[model samples]
Target: MKNLGARTGFLITLGLVSLCLAPCQAQTQGSGTKSTTASAIFPNGEKGSAQTFTGTVWVQNLVATDSIYQLASGSVTFEPGARSFWHSHPSGQILLVTDGVGYHQLKGEPRQTIRKGDVVKCPPKIPHWHGASADSPMTHIHIVPNTEKGIVNWLQAVTDAEYHGAR
Candidate 1:
């Protein structure tokens, strides 16, 4: 019985030691890897062009790749009443809302309200448009993956009639 108690005590101590060291090991193990620096911060982004968006919008390009399985990512800020032209990605796109209120609508579908923490996934070649609501500005992180054939195909602008038709 004494030997069994000793064994159990030894095992408990070993477990406690492992738990204490695990986080320290994790912290130190990645020290040799390249550390992220201030260079990661991207400054002011470019203004959205009239050819691509209906109203004032700013885009900050975060990543663009030309290699296999091409990808592009950016943060887009839309002013109140601003929106993208109807468009579709050759591959697919993801929108992660970061702030404020917005709208997303697929072709032939009713506009859907989107807010912070909402994630919108648009399938390849599916026509869609997204923008800030008329009363609020909005920001979202847009990620496009598999861009080997290029990224977007812009169509007609969304008309006021369409925008107000959301139910």
Candidate 2:
């Protein structure tokens, strides 16, 4: 537990600091109400393609993967019930849940409920999927390392059964 606080509290502080420093944009729902976002720091970047996501999803690119750093950072926001297709990272990925309730599952493992201040470390090459819960929106900052080997290998979408079934 030595670095647990660092991973959670310090990370949150850092995120907030970055959020204040980064350019941000307002997000409005179809109903015209202001909505909380995935990375409150960055603006809603691009809408995730239907092939890569189930429902409405927004992805904001932060740090671009470059040869020198070989890393990528981004924030993803999911509307209620939105989720990504099953995917794997060549190296690995870390998820910092900044807001709302959500689910994360690795292939063959029971799903885990995640919320604000939670940190999820996904192992290399492990197939997994994550998104907002049925009734709540969610957002997380994803940090991918070792991008020189490739970032992610996207697979099939998580079926409704796979997503809504028992944890």
Candidate 3:
């Protein structure tokens, strides 16, 4: 029964993530007579575990690492004030911000505000943390390259003092 409760909570969180990420608008270029928008609505893969994140977070894995591709990718959405634990990738990770506002901080550096259309590069083996700001949710596409060397190294959870310290 305890396990079922936990799963239920995760499902509720997943529902919130889906609601936030499910909206998309079509844009017609030049001619109203043509449906010219080329947009893809990605599948919402899974709910992030409480072990890995605080609050509600969603991940949609789009690519799996293979001999040919050598890269793995997924889209992540953070609910307002939600954030990931301190972690690092072995071969580095790239974040393509797609919506709303967020905060990112490399270990020992100040927090930086991130917004839609921003691209953030997290250097290999460097500890960092990222999440949605207090006032807004955030969504980003994360690309991790060179998986043979390994992927992320999860560290400690970001303390409230650390998260609220964002500038």
Best by lDDT: 2
What lDDT does the true structure give each of the candidates?
Answer: 0.84, 0.89, 0.84
C-alpha positional error of residue 62 in candidate 2 after TM-score superposition, expressed in Å: 0.3
TM-scores, all candidates, are 0.72, 0.77, 0.75
Per-residue lDDT of 59-167 in model 3, one digit per residue for the tens?
8898988988889999888888999999999999999988778999999998899998999999999999999998787888899999988988999999888898843
lDDT of 1 at 123: 86
Q: What TM-score does prediction 3 earn?
A: 0.75
lDDT of model 2 at position 155: 98
Predicted candidate 3, C-alpha RMSD: 17.3
Top candidate, metric TM-score: 2
Error of 3 at 3 (Å): 73
Across residues 33-61, which tens digit of lDDT does each residue of candidate 2 receive? 33674336567689999999999999999
Name the weakest run of 10 consecutive residues (lDDT summed) in model 2.
25-34
Clashing pairs in 1: none
